[model samples]
Target chain A: MKYEILEHTADLKIKAYGKSLEELFMNAARGLMSVMYEEESSKEGKEVSDVVLETSGPDKEALLVNWLSDILLESDTRNVYCFDFSIHTINEQKISSTMKCIKSVAKEDVKAITYHGLTIKKHNGKLEATILVDV
Target chain B: MFSKEILQKVQKNIWEIPKSYREDMCVPARVFASERMLDDITTDRSLEQLVNVSTLPGIQEFAISMPDIHEGYGFPIGGVAALSVEDGVISPGGVGYDINCGVRLLKSKKTVKDIESSIVDLANQVQRDTPSGVGRGGELVLSQDEMDELLEGGVPWIIKKGYGLEGDEEFLEQGGRFDEADSSLITDHAKKRGRDQVGTLGAGNHFVEVQKVHEVLDDEIAQTFGLFKDQIVVMIHTGSRGLGHQVCTDYLRVMVQAMAKYDITLPDRELASVPFLSKEGQEYFKAMNAAANFGFCNRQVLTHLVRGSWKQIIDKKEDLSILYDVGHNMAKRETHDGKEVVVHRKGATRAFGPGHPEIPKQYQSVGQPVIIPGSMGTFSYVLAGTNESMKQSFGSTCHGAGRRMSRKKAKKVIDYNKLKQELDEYHVVARAGSARGLVEEAPGAYKDIDDVVNVVQETGIAKKVVKLKPLVVVKG
Candidate 1:
């Protein structure tokens, strides 16, 4: 499975898995989008817009948080819902990506991405991460 | 990793983990909970988080947690700490991501008997008049200049704009404005996020509820606050929406990077902070205050909306006055024990006792009004600050019932139809924008608010005044 929801007392948690780092990041974004758009109606009646984003962090965890934060910022300020993500290049310190944004409404407002008990690990030749989102 | 043996029982309802429990702890950590409540607290990392909070520099007295404490990012929810302003540090996590997320109570002239038949209509009207749910914008969008004024002037500016009633500011905490707010310190991105969100209630636990005073625990104090058994009141629970979240996110990054420069090391990166006197700290304080102003005005607009909704079914001239408004997540500079300290109340309420100059003159003989909302469909409470709270808890008390079960668990265990039927049994109406949201906030998800309030009262931090039962709930 690409992603699964975990139980949290006061927030939402998602566990994502992928065969590669890029896939892991992509799956995490998809998981967040799923939480934010729980209703199918939010996905209808919107034209897609192309957008490119570039950011770098000291490590992979920071990079993941930065990437998600950028998505949240764009979704709130630009009034667009992200439907898809494509990672062109990713390294230890930098990542470049293109995301497809659609004109849709959200069903939930994810306040911020938290770092509490945040970790990314590899097992059985696969990358996995458990991320918590403050709703 | 916390063992029960590490805690020393201080009293029937108090427990303490001495400074020696952790080598780096600068002060002892204390928790107020009954035996039953302590078991729930021990199921999570709240105690360990409290120990981590104790390690912060210049933390005076004790790092404390209320009975309702639960696991959070850094400091646990229902946490309290007082840091000496002269030598202390300010952590953004202490004030939480939602700056000034608070509750406001409005008392009406009508009683439950008068509004018994119209509860459903009132709930429907409130849900329609108030813009709610995710990505929903309100009718009152602000220009950049007007937004700046709101960030600084708070409810006063909103009142001048013909949104709220005049003299309403008198009933708010800090008169609904913080003098130190600096709009220039607020980022443009934050401004953009807030421009359309004012007067809107965002999703996930934010709500507007019509409540009835079912019981009066302290008649004298209830009378002083204009509350009587069977009176109908309105409660609004929300905060500085996206603007506050962005402000915290922006400052957390700054503080995380500044930690190394200041030669500071913490057990967790989420506890990133700077000395209160530092430039970065001052900038964060100013920006935080600005976001808090946004929260204050946000509630005021909702108050106006509630008043309008009430007018639709009741008399147009009927009075629905604000009893009190308090910010549960905040850091305020106050004088404690004759020393200047910045008290951080994450998921706690300020319960300053009688005669405190910060309260309104009319309430000086009593104490600051404290509103504690229960889980959806449960019993909420009204309490007053006490002198013992000022002495023991830095003038703070518990905020709510606190979560006992996770939202995911609630969704799994609770049948939505059955829950709706249960509310029907209580003569309560529940309205929501999403079905999943309602299940997530099921009454079974939280601890019993009565138990939480009893601990606070027994501990002498706050005294009970009244108990309110929800008659109608409108969720975002």
Candidate 2:
């Protein structure tokens, strides 16, 4: 279980788990940065930015909603809060990654990254997905 | 997963579900609600997302929702459909990621007994001149030719860059510009996330309350819009922040790859679609009317910063006018029953009755005000629009008090200090950026804005004329 938080009523559902497909797109960017910094827990000593991204969608659920909407638009236009995702090349359309961001500060406002009940599943031999953010 | 025993009662407080309960419906789906709010709207996949919005394509006479229906994310939050601009389809998840998330009311000449001792310093100076949480950013930035003259001169180009006032663009709505907005069809990352989020207020359940006029159910339509009773008003709620959530995440990823070059098969890839005269649906309907003219210039620059916090805390010539500015996540291009469709209204509310020739001739004999807003210590409304809501709801209604619990069950049974001691036992004067976004906007997590405006004034779709309550709320 690389991710879990599901229970939406007005957006912010998660499910992520994987065994490849670049670890379900890096646990769906660690379940959209753990439900967007769920009440901000310390991410200590700031200034750590490594970025590098790329997107393409045609499949794999629009390449996982253009890879978590380009890590939520590089964490809301570079205000910064992304997490540890490092998928180096994915398929079913496109992806390339490298992450680790921080200048954090987001106690809610993950407003877009929804394909409602998106899918990316498999059973027994594990793999999962269930995203939806729009908070 | 469809049940409410396939609803039927299609009249008094309406309800239907037909279209053979599936097999890719193309019609039947209504739902005004009340039969005890249809057991809290069939306990929620919003009637299977209004039966997948009656299977899209050219939807017309049905596919409605408005009893403040819930379960949003691809049209369910108080939905409404209407399609057919010759041939339908235009889903930016049917206008959800805050494209024109709206509400605006204002109207102050002092009351609540002349501002009961300046209600908590006018809600802490209107939450310090309107800069709210989550990616805040305000103090009016712009530039990029003033965000393309505010994405094509909306709010009369922010009232000629002096923010606003002079007849606040005739009580808003379309007066706040929508000349098929086209700031070069948006993007420069939606103008760098809406260059400094014009007059910000960007969190969930956005707000900026401070009301009063508690009750007057139509004294000649609340004196034709200048409302009365204990007077003092001001509502706000927000929209188009982060440039209408990145122009709906850049056209729902260019309509999910132009829905395979317009073959448009959808059972929810978040309702992605094309053809409203494709070219990627007329460039996402002119970039969603330039993100709805940056949501009417981000609530007319937060009504010019809540009229400079009611003239810096209740005096220096406090006027605060503009009595209407609705938008409830739009789509517009109406005409109804005389054809030319395209309505949409996600989280509905248009309500254009009483001599509707686009209202405002001093409210053309009393209509088009319809504000709604409740939850955050309940009671809020203003209602008007009718001709029986343009023959039963194409002139839509209902926009708030909708969420029936679940910001994770309202933060697992609210208790942010007992919901701030029940909003200080209703003397209110809250203010937050997050006390868990104020216990996930708890007013018992909504639905009961007087039973959703008494099912839109007992089904005429809208009429109630006043009742407001809160005395300063402000959130983000």
The complex in candidate 1 yields a DockQ of 0.69
DockQ of 2: 0.29
lDDT tens readout by residue for model 1, B155-179: 9999999878889999999999999
Any runs in candidate 1 off by more than 4 Å, and if so which? Answer: A39-45
Model 2: per-residue Cα lDDT over A38-135, one tens digit each: 54456787678898888898889888888788788878877787776787877889888888888777777888888888888887788888888878
Best of the candidates, TM-score: 1
Candidate 1 local lDDT, residue B91: 93
Q: Which ten residues in a row have the lowest lDDT in candidate 2 chain B?
A: B1-10
lDDT of each: 0.90, 0.84
- Which candidate tops lDDT? 1
The local distance difference test score of model 1 is 0.90
What is the per-residue lDDT of model 1 for residues A14-70, given as tens digits with 9 covering 90 to 100?
Answer: 799999889999999888887776533454566779989997776788778778877
